[model samples]
Every structure is written in structure tokens, then in C-alpha cells.
Target: MTTTGTEIPGPAGLPLLGSMLDLKRDSLGTYLHAQREHGDVVRITAGPPGLRVEIYGVFSAEGAQQVLATESANFRKDNPFYEEVRQSFGNGLLTSQDTDYLRQRRLVQPLFTRRRVDGYAASITDETSAMLATWRNAPDATVDVAAETTRLTLRAVARILFGVDVESAVDVVQRSFPIIGEYTLTRGYSPANFPRSWPTPANRRATAAMDELYAECDRIIEKRRADGDAAMGEDLLTLLTHAESDEDTPLDASEVRDQVLVFLLAGHETTATSLAFALHLLARHPEEQTRAREEVVRVLADGRVPGAADLDALPYLTKVLKEAMRLYPAGPVVGRQAVAASEIDGHTIPAGATVVVAPWVTHRHPRYWDEPERFDPERFTPEREKARPRYAWFPFGGGPRACIGQHFSMLESVLALAMILQEYELEAVDVEVPVSTGITLRAAGPARCVLRPVGRGTGPA
Candidate 1:
């Protein structure tokens, strides 16, 4: 239990390049190998040969708890890596640190209240129903479930949270989001790349995409403001514009813009990716899929769409989603920089060092999960969950910095899954979909599935 930096063991990387190549080539595999070789906490060098960066990989639930909860204050999000995110997303809640983050959290917390989120359930089901209608028109074609889910979630977020129809902007978002995400990841991970200020082709393309995104945000805000009180619905944009702190200070225009942008990106992307993975898993496991469908049918026997109140009754759907995230958490890795020297599991964490808590690794840690690699929804059953440490299954992360849209994401996911299952049965065209990780975890390519209409043979009435 002694605190000694050198006491912690890790692979001695190749000279100069160190582990940077391994990280660039396969970050997940690199972390997994480190965990297998050097226990829970392992150090690895990143960055370039001349300016290598050292980061400690924490792979155990206890270590995750330490970094994300108990010793959270000693760690801060003010790292060089987050600068990339800040450039694109601004100082929104996701990338803000310290007092600024605290203030923003308080200002926005009211928007995610259970009452507010519950109100969006109908919109979620309606959006899914609309998407299903489109799917039904071409039931026999090989549909890209991943792309379709992304579209569904984006539409729901835009309408439910912004109170505006973004049907036209969907194509813009679909084209820009991936480029922006990939660019941000490159800058964050490989700092040696051309400076963002450089007018390189890739940089120019990313900048153009970002500009288009910001312009759309402005358009939404301007349109809402033009509508005056009539547009002042309970949507997130209204809440952000009208929000005030205890001292009665309101957020500035720039602040509102940043917040909206963050919500637009984060609120939709993570949920969409998770849903795609969930559907992919279900398609591969027919028994699990049938069990989930039965639960949906039993609850909604009258053929009504699922609402927030129906959530509790849909236990298996929740488990299937939970298990899907366990295998492929939307946010696979979470990072923090040690603000001060600390000790975790007896290893000395020096001040200013990067501390990583990867759910991708911890969720699969052999010590915590039984048959770690297997897809088993039973792992999330209440009794089983109660038996494990709280941090053992943190797909949404832990602590104050956890996702603000967790409840919203869960409701959207559950409702969408239920509605889709009730209408159509999906068969996997390719069960072996590979994962690609950048800002979030996603299927490397389209998760193709052949859709078959339920016995009704038509769209929902």
C-alpha cells in the first residue's frame, strides 16, 4: 500500500515513439494488453518522441471509483487533450472545468428534471414511429440500422429539445458530425498533427463543417427569438435562453449557443450509437430479441406506443440496453488530469499526470464480470447489480461530471427500442460489425439489417 511511482509496473515502450504507435494503431487493444500484463493501474507513454506524455490507465472498478468519485476533486478536466473539444464545442458543460463547470451545471440542471424529461416521451415515440414508417416502405432491403437510428435520435433531439423541425438540417449534420468528431479525436490524441490554425485540407474541411453547424444553431436560436413568447416552450433552448442563476445573472448569447451545440451533439450521438449497438446485439441473439419483444407486446397489448410510465414495466428492454452498453459503452473512455499528487491502489499519481478510466476495459475486467465477454442481460438484474460494486458497471460514467442527459438518453433509447420491436423484426445482414472509437464508440461501418414487417404487414395505425 506504499505510495511509490516507480513501484507501478508497465511495458517499456520502444525508444522515442514509446507507445504512441500502439495507441494510434489500436487504443482498445493497447489498454487491454496493459491491463492483462500490469494489473489495474499501468503507465504508458503517448504524444511524439520529443514530447512524450505519460498517462496511467486504470482498469479496475476500485480504481475507477477513486478517479471518478472519492478522489474526484483532486482530479480536474483541465488537460491539453480537452483543448481540442473546447475549440469545437466551446466551454460547454462537457468540457468545462472548476467554477465555470459548476455554474453551468447549476444553470442547466433544471432542464433535465424528471418532469421535464417525462414530457419528451411522446416526442420520442412519435419520432421512432415516423422512422419505422420509412423503414416499412422498404422492408426487404438491407437497411443501415446504424444510420437510421442516428437519424431518428437526431430528429427527436432537435424537435423535443429545440422545439424546431430540423428535417432539412439532418443531411448537413450527418455529413459534418463524423468529420468533426474524427478531427477532434486526431487533435486530441495526436497533438503532433498540423496545428488547427493551419489551412490544411483536413483542417479546412473540419472548419467548414463546424461553421455549418454553428450557423444552424444560430438559425434555430434566431427563429425561436423571432417567434417571441409563442416559441417559449419547455424545450432546452428556451430553458437555456431564459435560465438565470440565484443572483439573477443570465447566460450570454455565446454561452447559450455553446450549450445548445453541446446538447445537440452529445444528446443525440451517444444515444444513437448505443441504440445501434443494442439492435445489432439483438439481431444476433434471436432468443434474447424474442424475449424482449414478448415483454413489449405483453405491456402494450392494446398496440399503444410506449410512454415514460411504461418504462418500469419494460425491464428486459432496459437490461438489453444495459448489457449492450456494457459490451460497447458509447463513451468508452473517460480522462482526468490529477490536479494534485494522489495515491490510488497504493500507486503514486504525480501532480499533472493524466488518469484514464476506460469503461471499455473495466466493464470487461475478469475480476468483476462473470463470463466477461458474453452478452448476458441477466447481469443487470436488480439482485445481481446490487451484489457488485457501484463502479463495476458505469456506462454513463460516475460523479458530478457524469452525463447530464442520462435520463433523457435512457427514455429515448427504451421507447425507440420498444416501438421498433413492436413494428418490425430485424435480421442481421452482417453480425460481425467492427467497432471504431474516436470521441465515442460506434460501428466501424453501417450495421446492415434486413427488416421484416410484423404480422400486420403495414405501418402502425
Candidate 2:
């Protein structure tokens, strides 16, 4: 892993401040610009000399693979962002490492198998239908696609995860998560900040939010346990309460709470981002929308809700989703801390340096994608996909720590899209929605869409 190499190239910065101001201004743009100007492996330094922070950027597909997969162990989640997430949300799958991560992954893996996740498709269908029903009552048949999808995903994931206690969990999640997410981002990036113990307004708000969130999860878990519902159904909360591995013990109450928080955060936000952007992109491109709708009609004829089995039957629609994710990855940037000095794409990344594998930039790598800005689902056709490197289009991440709920995410997205397009024809009211990253990619403005019921001959009535 070690090889002598030239010093990395990067943007020159003002004394003491380094590139801090540039990153603070626009993190996404700074990453993209750095790649375009300094090549794949660039050094990004911030802060003054005594407290300097250096980030190593890995933009190539090959380098991304190395950081996230090939040499994954060496690039641990020891970065400030991950630490911030752990402090705000407990150390569940997204933040845990070493043996703790392996143990948690083993216990949680069976719950996310294709068969188990597919069983929740009915929940996704019910939620999507409910959302569409509200759309029918919208004035002028228009809606904010981002806001609606966020509600849809939140309700669906909450229902599946909390079962009978869904209502209690949903309210807490809706009210609390945004506060914690914003607080984490602010503190995660700043080199120095007021301690969480300080009675600062932001600290107090974040603490209160976390307290409410934790209390709700604990109450739900207690109810699930006392009711002896672990054997009554296979809901995620129930499964996690009794989750076990061949040689490991079941998770305790605190551990269960951590896992629940992770699922609540990961399950809803990422899928909502994909769905919102997918519909927005489709509305802007009528031809692609028509093509996708045609596929949806053939697969779910008579407005039948798509189940897990139906996913494979709707290839074109799936491709459309893939393209949407490529353009707007939910987790735009992933960070890790290098455990040792290692050469990546001919540049040496020193030990303890913060390393970034930004899907936002890699997904648009000029060498891999032709007209990377264009929305073209055809690029994902089996033939075209086979020609590209695996890391070139990783939206859910990669390697052993890849997103566990990936299957569930795909199932939920495809089913929702199919159900929506089956009944409504969409036209974009706002084509270019501004986007920025928080815990996941977020729309900076309204992505409005006007919906018209599909003509009888065009789709199921």
C-alpha cells in the first residue's frame, strides 16, 4: 500500500484560513472545482498551522473503490463528521466501526435480506396510494414534489419500523430530526465550537431534540417488548428487539434504540431524495416520463401496486431511478480518516488525514460519463452498465459497509414511481430545483409539479 510519490496538488489559500472559507461557501462546488483543477487526488488544507486540517480528495472511480472497498479497513470512519453524527444519533450501523460494526451488521443483516425487505412492499404501496389520494385533492392539481415525497417516505418507513406505534414515532421524527441534522452539520465542519454542554441556544435545541427522539424510541421499544410482539409480526422494530446472530447475543435496549435511529434516518431521507429528484427529472423531460409511464402501465396494469416481485419486471422505470440517483446522490460526500500513509492514484495520502469520496463528483467524472449532466436512463441499460467501473455510479456506497437497506430503498422507489405515474401525468412547474447537502442531499427550493390524470387509453384510470 505504500509507495513513494509526488506531493499532492490543490488550491492555494490565504494564510491561516486555508480553503475554509471556500468550503464553507459551497462544499459541493469546492469539491467539483478541486477535481476539475487539480486532478483526482488533491490535498485540501484548512485552519491555521497549529490546528491545521488537511483533507485528501479521491475523485476517480478507481480511487473511490480503494477508499470505500479495497482498502476500506485502513480508511476508518474516524472523521469529524462521523463523530458528530454518532454524538447526535448514537453509534449504530452508520457510525460504528471495528468489532462493534461487525456485530451490529451481523445481527441486522438477516432483517434486510431481499425476501424480508420485499415483504414491506405492501407498506410502501399503501403509503404511496395515500399520498396520491391527497394529490387528487390538491388545488390546480399541483404539488411540491420534494415536500410530498418527504412525507410519503417518512410515513412509510415509520409504519414499517414501528408497526402499531408508528404514529408516536412519526411525530417525534418529523419534529426532531431536522434540528439534529442541521446542528450536526454546523458542528461537524467547524474546527472549533461551543461544547454541547454549553447552554448555547443551538446546543440546547439540539439536546432537546435528541432527548425527545430518544424518549420516543425507548417508549416504543418498551411497548413492543411488554406486548410480546416480537413473535406476533416481523416488523423491523420487533425483529431488532429479538435480533441475534449465530454466536452473538441479542441487542439490549440502548443498542436497539441506536439501530432504530439509524434506520429512521437512513430509510426515509435517502429514498425521499431519490423519489423527489426522479419525479422532478421526469417532469422536466416529457419524453422520458412518457417512456417510463409506458413501462409502468405494462407492468402494473389496472393500477395494481408493484410488489417486490414486480420490480424486475419494470426495467426501464428502474433505469430512470438509477439515472436520477446518479445526478443527485442522497449521500453526496462520504468521509473517512486514513489509518496509514497510502498511495492512491499515484498520490500519497498521509496517516490521520481526512479522506473524501464524493459521489457528487465521481458520478459526474468526465472520463466515465458522456454528457454527465444529461438525464439519460439508457446509460444504465445492462450493456452500458457493464462497460463502466463499479464505483463509477455508486449512490448507496460500496464495499462491506455499503448501505444495508439498499434493496428496500429500490423497492420503495420503484413501487412509488409506478403507482404515481400509473394514475397521473406530470409536468414540471419548476425544472431546475436548487440542491444542497445536509445529512443527505436536500432541495434548496420547491420542486413543483403539475399533475393531470392520465387519459384512459394512456394508463389505468
Highest-TM-score candidate: 2
lDDT of 1 by residue, 225-266 (tens): 788788878777887888878854677778888888788788
Q: What is the lDDT of candidate 2?
A: 0.91
Off by over 4 Å in 2: 1-6, 229-231, 456-461
Considering only N, C-alpha and C atoms within 3 Å, which residue pairs clash in candidate 2?
Answer: none
lDDT (tens digit, per residue) of candidate 2 on 41-127: 998888877777888899999999999999999999998889999999899999999999999999999999998999999999999
Question: What C-alpha root-mean-square deviation, in Å, does candidate 1 show against the real structure?
Answer: 2.3
TM-score for each of the candidates = 0.95, 0.97
lDDT of each: 0.85, 0.91
